[model samples]
Target: MTDATIKTAAMLAIGDELLSGRTKDKNIGHLAEVLTMAGIDLKQVRIVGDEEEAIVEALDALRERYDYVFTSGGIGPTHDDITADAVSKAFGVPCLHDPDAMGLLSEMYQRRDMEFTDARQRMARMPQGSRHIANPVSTAPGFVIGNVYVMAGVPQVFQAMLDTVVATLPAGTRILSRSLPCPFGEGDIGTLLGAVQKAHPETSIGSYPHFDGKRFSTELVVRGRDARALDAAAHDVAAMIEALTMEREGAKSKDLGTGELA
Candidate 1:
């Protein structure tokens, strides 16, 4: 089952703590890695303070442009957890109690012999005509409204919800990636890497530089949906790095001679 091609998605991480740096985000990296493996390209990610209007605007924009929008944070039992309302307003629908969600919450609370207070019951609220996304970490469910998924900010709950969401999504053409490690600075081989990129326009080529205290190294990764294209680009990148390394080695050897040869 497929709808609209290209299979792209955007993620929204909602919280004032995120904007304030009080709570470090763990969901973005997790989502990016998971989505890539699932073959759904995660194209964009945004963080908004726990503001309803901000959530509405961001959700509207992303849901319109991408195949799906996965939002994290602001869906708990606190006053700032207004994601459900914001999502409902975004779709111009009423945020109402879901019977299935209600039953689940009610049963859980009853088992604990605790009153299902209004505040706790809010977790059962969802946008009208939406389906629930199960949360294994917490009983309160996340939900999907249109193409937007509203989830908890807590890493555990978010991860649990993500697994549930991924199962329902359609897999796309998987992106293949290969890395060529070069034991030299990126500047040493930037020119050759650029030429390799030009030669394989279909693939995405990136150079990541790293230092291991004693030396510098760069890892060049080539990514594309076509396996053959990916392999070709990787081969070109390897050859370029090899040639540059050899040239640098030759120059070093010549410098060491230091006028010994007339």
Candidate 2:
């Protein structure tokens, strides 16, 4: 793809457990990393409760706003799993049990000698005309409707579904990144870093600070789809760090010469 070709996506994290902190949501980070590597920029993330109204609202908004909208959670057999119904409502379609999905779940259950009860069969329900995204971890598949992908909330299952979905998506220009360790803190290079960022409009520069009991440091990270711009921004960031280091050394030397504390 061309350097200018960029795909943007949003994530909708569904479930009341996530909001209540009862079940820690572990799928967002993996999705973000996978999307980035696949050349899709994740621009927005929304976490909503298991309520159908909330899920439908989020799906509608995100699907219209981004090239792709991936939803995690609320796709299980439980009564609270309303993602399929919400997705059907969002697209003005009926949520029905797909025969293919039912067959797959049926075979899986039969092979394992487990009863494919009505509750388990709920996993086969999806929006009308949606395509299934095979879940390698769990036999119950996620589905894609319009621009939205409804996947399971379980970390392993979500990751597996993401692999299937990403493989089918058209890849754009992959964003590249570099990280530089800075001995100085933000106070030492804040203004200089800002100037560098302004100079490189195509690249994004960020400074994250860390402390280790006795000293504080910063890590300057540069990211961009254009390799040249990313490199240029990283170079400027390194120069800023070097300049600050030199100034600190020079000040310390001056203090030593004058017999004063630095």
Candidate 3:
């Protein structure tokens, strides 16, 4: 990731089940964390039904906006499966059976002494001018065309495909995160946090608050690509939290001085 431009990506989970609440999505978080670790920023995630137009529209929008677009679902053996076709339409290419993918599926089915039915062969269909993505879990492979990589919806299969694609993507500056759990709430440090943000314009600072029965606490997370700048910002945030905490405690406890200013 040294001397590299910031690379960005987006994920599109295509499934009617996801939209209908029959299935819960787990790939977004996995991909986001993986891409971030790989120095590629995962900018956004979207979910659409298994419709061709919706998939095409989302694909076109995302591919134009980000460096890479990863899609999950709709390339199965069922009749409603249509992601490959939609991707082909978006790229203005034909959908056809990929010989490499067919050979892999054919061998797998042959080894199992199972018939390679047409339905099963649908897994080999890919958009023209696309390359296959290795699937270690299943013999049927995914495809990558242009900046878009179409993969399986199943979590295990999706993870394997991600591992296969990581080596092919460009690297960006690795983002670093530092977090401090503070006793101060958002109200106590809203103004000060704003000031910290203004002071460290290169880093991103976010406040996550939590409360149950007694105390209002927050976790301040600071992120940046530059280690020096990130450490400076994190130090300030910790000091600010400490100062605010002491101020609130000073009113109840004895001889507590005003802590360092943010």
In order of appearance, the predictions have TM-scores of 0.93, 0.94, 0.93
Off by over 4 Å in 3: 1-4, 213-215, 254-262
**Candidate 1 deviant stretches above 4 angstroms:** 1-4, 212-216, 257-262
Candidate 3's residue-wise lDDT over 1-262, tens digit each? 2233888889999999998999999988889989989989888899999899999999999999988999999889999899999999999999999998889999999999999999999999999999999999987899999999999999999999999899777667689999888887789899999999999988999999999677677899999999998999999998998788778777656634655444
Q: Which of 1 and 2 is ahead in lDDT?
A: 2
Q: How far out, in Å, is residue 28 in model 1?
A: 0.6
Clashing pairs in 2: none
- RMSD (CA, Å), candidate 3 to true, equals 4.2
RMSD of each: 3.5, 2.4, 4.2
Per-residue lDDT of model 2, residues 79-192, tens digit only = 999899999999999999999999999999999999999999999999999999999998999999989988999999999899989999998777899999999878888999
lDDT tens per residue, model 1, 77-185: 7899999999999999999988999999999999999999999888999899998889877799999878898889999999999998998888887778998888888
